[model samples]
Target: METQLGNGPAGIRGDLSATDLAKALRQGWRDFAARPQYGLFFASFYVAVGIGLYYLFMVRGETRWLIAAVAGFPLFAPFAAVGLYEVSRRLEQGLPMGWTHVLGALRGRGDEQLLLMGGIIFVGFSFWVIIAHMIFAIFASAAGLGEGMAFLTSQMGLTMLAVGGAIGAIIAFIFYAMTVMSLPMLVDRDVDFITAIITSFKALSANFAVLLLWAVMIAVALFAAILPYFLGLLVVLPVLGHATWHLYRRTVG
Candidate 1:
């Protein structure tokens, strides 16, 4: 019998190459340039959120919220990319590129599967924040270090950072494997969330090296984008979001 996941048919998996990364980036740039308004419009949401978070944490002195937001920020990227995916999809299909069309795609036909996937992302982010808090408590107490930036200047703080970084990497890779293509697949097809996630894992397994490289590139780009008060995300996020759609196209038949 043919493989099936949930109520939807399985997706066909394809091979990927390092070169595809460059190609996807080029196409993503083209798409962004072709529709600068949409790219900026979608990206502005992320910028607004970033600035809002900064205002809450720094200006208003909400350190707890800051910790949670920083820990969970990565989880927001895939969801934010949904609009860019729609934009690319429309561009690829030669469909109308109006705000109504692009924004309406966000409704996603009331698809529960996309919501399911989003729930998973949120859960993963919540888990990470909890883990981060625990790690902070354990290390900070042990080292007699106080909370906030003071910890970073001490040995215990450095150790905590190291341990947290290692753990965060593992979690991030697992999430990346699960959703790298699943989001686009979810938007592009009628597949169940589970199937889309499984297909994403299989694609990562089959093309581990290239996909890992792609993941690393994404991480590095995001880190750099975040350094400048998250303003850089205005450009970086949309490009990466559009590139991801092309990458999904190349990886899934």
Candidate 2:
């Protein structure tokens, strides 16, 4: 069993050796694969969501409706939190990582995790909305109030789009860092939400470069996996999600 200590608000501070981290990550994948059902469940959920969205975009082709559908992405975070918690629980409890464990986590903390996930989704999505509004206001001001952004074009237009993407990326990074370890930590410890968030940030700050590498790897893998029939996500999503559980364990404690 993994050792649990009495480290309060103070979290794991020192850096982990790259070799050790790598080993943990590899082991995580092994354990994850050993329990294929967990991966399948995650993958199936992701594929269903992706297929639904693609159907909306490709078949329906309604931009407004698509945008509305996009709004639901935030809602997924709550349900995902349960999976994240389950992965951690299995790891900490020395239980066989399987479908039973995943379902058990959902059954046990379904309500609480959903509530926490809902809170996280609201705050994160609200931040996105605010930032988007700011971008809109800035664009509107430059193009003259009440007038559309017809003037934004060519190099300048692309630049604005790039800037917007950068802003979104930054938001993503912040949220990823904030929640990466926090969710699993919450499952493993009797800690409050605020502390979990704070500790997550600290872990991210401590391991920014490596975490960034992990994020890039995940993004690239996911992008490639989804390229051929979004159904591919059925395999990719679970691997990455389970891999993430391992990454957090290795990188943090």
Candidate 3:
């Protein structure tokens, strides 16, 4: 029988290797295939959210909204995977799938752990959005607040991209460390958000190199999948969501 991860300071196996990533990917694909309907249903939320944000950004023509739209989906992805985690968990337990059961799992054992974790995600994203606007403001002032392709191609504009991208990457990685296992652990166990966060940090710190590679894989795949207006999420989101649940299983005990 699989060991249940403890509520406090959950033990991390800490020996995850490259092979485990591959195996998890395979299992994730199998899970998606076994229940494509659920995958599609869950992934559709991401697609719709992505498109709506993009539309609002394009329509309003504001730097902050544009930054939010571009960065929101990628950074907020872990939270969106809750349902997929539920799906993968059910498949693992050979339990029947249903919309209500999976959706209720987002409430997370009725202890509000999921809600806390979600707040962290939202605050982190909001901070990034603010920082992103500040970065743009500096560059925009340099360009005399001119609005055109000219500034975008200028050296100052390029520097803004580099700086903003670097800071955003750091913030994203921090959230990744926080949520990579916490979300699945929350869905699978009845722990508080603090324990889940610390356990997640322990798991990442213990296997830094391998897990960093896993983060890179997620970033690259998500970038590619999101490029085509999030259509690829219908496949990529579920696969990664399940793959993450599998990874969580191996890391946290």
TM-scores, each model vs. reference: 0.91, 0.71, 0.93
Candidate 2 residues 1-253, lDDT tens each? Answer: 5333223224454354466456655755665566666666666776677668768675754432333334334334324645745774576568776566666665444446435744775677667756655664466456553222343453444455567667766766667776777776666566666777777787676766767776666556666766675566666666556656666666555
CA lDDT, candidate 3, residue 37: 88
TM accuracy, model 1: 0.91
> What is the C-alpha lDDT profile of model 3 across 1-253, one tens digit per residue?
5343432233677677899999999999999999898889888988998888878777767754576457655778899899889999999999988988888888889888899999989999888888888888878787774544566678887787788889889999999999998889999998899988888998888788889999999999988988898889899988999999999988885
lDDT scores in order:
0.82, 0.58, 0.85
Of the candidates shown, which would achieve the greatest TM-score relative to the real structure? Answer: 3
lDDT of candidate 3 at residue 131, scale 0 to 100: 85
**In lDDT terms, which candidate is top?**
3
Cα lDDT tens digits for candidate 1, 109-205: 5778877777888899889988887887788789775677777678888888788888888998899999999999888988788888888888787
Candidate number that wins on TM-score, 1 or 2: 1
Instruction: Give the Å shift of residue 132 in candidate 2.
Output: 5.9
Candidate 2 — what's its lDDT? 0.58
List clashing residue pairs in candidate 1.
none
